[model samples]
Target: MALPTLISAAQLHEILEQNDLVILDSRFYLTDLQKGRQQYELGHIPGALFVDLHHQLAGDETEQTGRHPLPEPSELADTLMNLGIDSQTQVVVYDDMGGAMAARAWWMLVQQGIEVFVLDGGFPTWQRAGYAIEAGCNQATVAEQRLTISYPWLVSEDDVVANLETERFQLLDARAADRFQGENETMDPVAGHIPGAVNRPFMQNLNEHGLMKAPSLLLEEWTSLLQDIEKPIVYYCGSGVTACHNVLAMNYAGLEAKHVYVGSWSQWAKRILRKIDEANA
Candidate 1:
């Protein structure tokens, strides 16, 4: 059977030579946004195009939207074409901070009904494994803008509010333990996590090197946190970025869930009427 939701370094090396494969470098830092591109210029997977995590993954900020909102589907479709991505292209996305940022790119592509895979360990793993790395910018022929509206699998704040008491789902918070516990709310004005939500930091899916652990290992870790798989799993993080990593990890474990809370903590905390940290506490 084929590897699930993951692409190996060797496999990636082979695909790098293929015309249908599109490699995207998604390395980014919230504090230092330009660092990702700088690293890409230093060295990257051959033919890999740099996808700015802040610009490409998120929508424009508005009074109603969160810090990293999902962009308009048509706009994103245009971005995919510019990046040389198509329905049949085998996309491989990776980043430095575990797979959080990279998974955001992965999820965005999937929202367009394009099945793209995450690099299991990201660029470092590929380099450590002695895989070939090319320096400077790499470019490919931008694919024709051939995008079709598929399913909108993203969940909004309204959906979360309505399903608060429903037994049909579980809201999984991928934020850090401190943020979840309300001890540390440095990022947002409102401290603590959503009501009735459980904390499951996205980094738990990977090791120190930012690579995903074995599928069996991830299965055990996630199953322990969530006792039942029948219940629908909805994930959220600071701004819907890292949460996608958890979703992608779960998909790798053969437990693909539905409707991730894309707005995540950023949007969730903006509500004053709704209970914030107390519900889940």
Candidate 2:
């Protein structure tokens, strides 16, 4: 059987010595692009490789692709191969910011049917538990591999536009209330969210300890939002990063939110501006 989607720090510590295990530290700060690598060099879980959200997980920023577009499939595949992560390697990803950043790696791997896990509560939880921590960069033995990849859970910007008219998917925004409400606008040019999308901040998935809420509680909360709505659910957030957190939470609670708008609001807002400019021209 495949490993569960989430693993506690203690559970991960037990499997630390497994030959097939590959731990990835995806810690990132949206404001400071290089901070993730700096933190990784300072300290990280033993045998872990650092993956920068900007360079590794995301592709070049373009007018059409948004701030943090999904990396080309081959790009990530090559990175994994260089990390010696072949088909048999089991992956575990964690971040300092709860599971917000780590969930990005987890989502990408899971979509390819790879048996990967997000460290419950992430790196902070592991540190709190007094686990072994290593400093400096850890290198992997590179191996030759060509992985077959697919994004079954991804939805394109065009699909989101179409949903505005059809309502086939119940769109949810994973950004905070302030951002969703068009206040304190900073990241993107325009404010607010795509039409028909409701706010469901990703932080709601965590508790006072910054750990995930119990499965029952998660299910109960999701049930209230989904009551009698049969439409398939989709999630999006600024730059398509934190959105994965909500997706992970829903999946952990035994609910399916298989569709993610990878371009998310950053792309949507930019495209809206281009359209307005064209009309004014």
Candidate 3:
């Protein structure tokens, strides 16, 4: 049987002893790049390798790219191979922040057609459940086989602009309502969202306990928002990290969006600003 997209702490505990599984501790802090590794060194799930959000999950950011651009396919494949992930490996990723960062890892693996799961409720739930923790890193024996990258998951900035002009697809922003509305201008230099995008914060996907809502509940929430909209939805967040959380939730609800704007708001805002500068000149 294949593992579901989301797995509970109990389910994870049962499979911890399994050799073919690859567990990733994806804890990250946007403000402090070193925080995730610090936390991992302090304590993490046993037999889990640390996957840095910046170092492994994201590629280099250019003037036109988002803060967390998708890593190069070859780079990511090498990283996965270093982690001993081959075609047969089952990966489970978790973080301290309600699977927000962890979902990025999950989405990347799934895009490559690898079977992966986000630990529901993340590391906190595991700690709460009295599961054992191991300090320092537990590196995997590097695998000789390379994983293939299908590269079909993300939509580019050009695709988003075309969609906006054509109005052929619905645009969903996974940032907070304030950020979506151009109120909080903390992360990105620009304050506003895509011209016609709708706001649905990724955090809403979780319940009071920080665990993902039931699939039925997720379906209800997403269905209400997308009721009158068309298929082939496009989703984005500030830097394309939290947006994956929304994508994961939608997949859990059996609703698949067509594309994820890998550059997201950061790239969009930059392009918009450049246009403004050119017009002013």
Give the alpha-carbon lDDT of every model: 0.80, 0.88, 0.89
Residue 120, candidate 1: C-alpha displacement in angstroms: 1.3
Task: Evaluate model 1: give its TM-score.
Answer: 0.91
User: What's the TM-score of every candidate structure?
Assistant: 0.91, 0.97, 0.97
lDDT of 3 by residue, 1-281 (tens): 23247999999999999988999999999999999999999999999999999989999999989999988889999999999998888999999989999988988888776789999999999999999998987869898799876568788988888886788877899999998989968988889889888889999999999999999999999999988787568889988889889989988888775368879999998998899999999
Model 1, position 120: C-alpha lDDT score: 79
Ranking by lDDT: 3, 2, 1
Alpha carbon lDDT at 281, candidate 3: 100
Candidate 1 lDDT? 0.80
The TM-score of candidate 2 is: 0.97
- Model 2 ranges with Cα > 4 A deviation: 1-3
Q: Candidate 2 overall Cα lDDT vs. reference?
A: 0.88
- lDDT, model 1, position 243: 87
Off by over 4 Å in 1: 1-4, 165-167, 228-230, 273-281
Best-fitting candidate, scored by lDDT = 3
